[model samples]
Target: MARQLDEQIAGRFQVGQRLRVLDVGMGQGTQALRLARAGHTVTGVEQDTTMIAAARRDLAAEPEGIRDRVRIILSDGRDTGVHFLPGSFDVVLCHGVLMYVADPDPLLAGLARMLAPGGLLSLLVRNGDALAMRPGLSGDWAGALAAFDSNSYRNRLGLDARADRLDTLTATLAAIAAPLHAWYGVRVFTDLAPDGAEPPADLDALLAAEDRAGRTDPYRGVAALLHLCGVRD
Candidate 1:
């Protein structure tokens, strides 16, 4: 998925350009810190106090220069408009948060408003279209059958959440003036890996294979997550 984001950035911006990035629901500030380290200004917005502390702790351990490039905000993803002006960011990321939103389109539109013209909006969402794949592959016939009729499910954390279908999101993005540019599936082969499972001996090979599967047809459609990139019109 990082490769997919890098590809979008490489294709859209000049080499070595410093971008203003907004990471909404940036749990633990992983991506925000990465952008800051690359010399971009990053604003991380997260509502969870525990997650805020973890992100700040991680930031505190970074070099002074990188730390200066990052700012952490205690806010919900739906509150971007209240905190930032329109066209304030070059890139906006909302990953893993949509599933928690009962109505994601409004929040998504607000995020789009924060982007500058031609700015990139990157989203990582649960794949609604493939919700049955997990249970079907796990040999849970009942669960798989139920999933085929609904887009909501109980996640690994035992929390109930909803997913977004590609077609639905594509139309929503268009309505917000950020049409879909490219998309790829995420966790195609590794979705069922037990949490905290040890890394495979050939980690690079495994990652490469997954990455390839993510960008390929048929396989990508059945992935556990979807990475979608849209550009502001």
Candidate 2:
């Protein structure tokens, strides 16, 4: 996801430009901190208190310059309008967040409004179209059969979550005037890997294969996660 975002940013923005970034549902601030270190001013909004504390601790460990570029905000992503003016950021990220939102349209619209013209809106969502893949591959016939009929499922964390189909999202983005720009599959082959599993000895090769499959279709369509970018025109 990070690699894909970086590539998109590099392609769209000029080098040395100090972009204003807003990371909604930033969790532990992994992407937020990485962008801050690269000289982008980043604001991370997280609703979880424990996550906020962890992110702050991580920020504090960074050098002064990097630390100064990051701000942590305690707020729900849906309230972004209350906290920030429209068109305030060059990049707005709402990764791994929409599934938890029962009604994601309003939140997605708010995120789109946060982007400046030509700004990027990056999203990482579970692939509803491929929801049956995991169960089918695991030989869970009943689960696979059920998955084909619904987008809601219990995630690894045992939380009830929803998934998004690419086609549906494309139409939504168009309606918000942030049309789909680019997209890639994520964790195409590694979705079934055990939680917290150590990287294989040939980690680099694994990533290489994943990257290739992510951009190559038929394969990409069945990936577990979809990394989508929209441009606010």
TM-score of each: 0.99, 0.99
Error of 2 at 71 (Å): 0.5
Candidate 2 all-Cα RMSD: 0.7
| TM-score: model 2 vs. ground truth | 0.99
Cα misplacement distance, residue 164 of candidate 2 (Å): 0.4
lDDT of 2 by residue, 114-230 (tens): 999999999999999999999999999999999999999999999999999999999999999899999999999999999999989999999999999998998999999999999
The root-mean-square deviation over C-alpha atoms between each candidate and the true structure, in angstroms, is 0.7, 0.7
Worst 10 residues of 1 by lDDT: 74-83
Please report, in order, the local distance difference test score of every candidate based on alpha carbons. Answer: 0.95, 0.96
Task: Look at candidate 1 and give me any clashing residue pairs.
Answer: none
Where model 1 places Cα greater than 4 Å from the true spot, the runs are none
lDDT of 2: 0.96
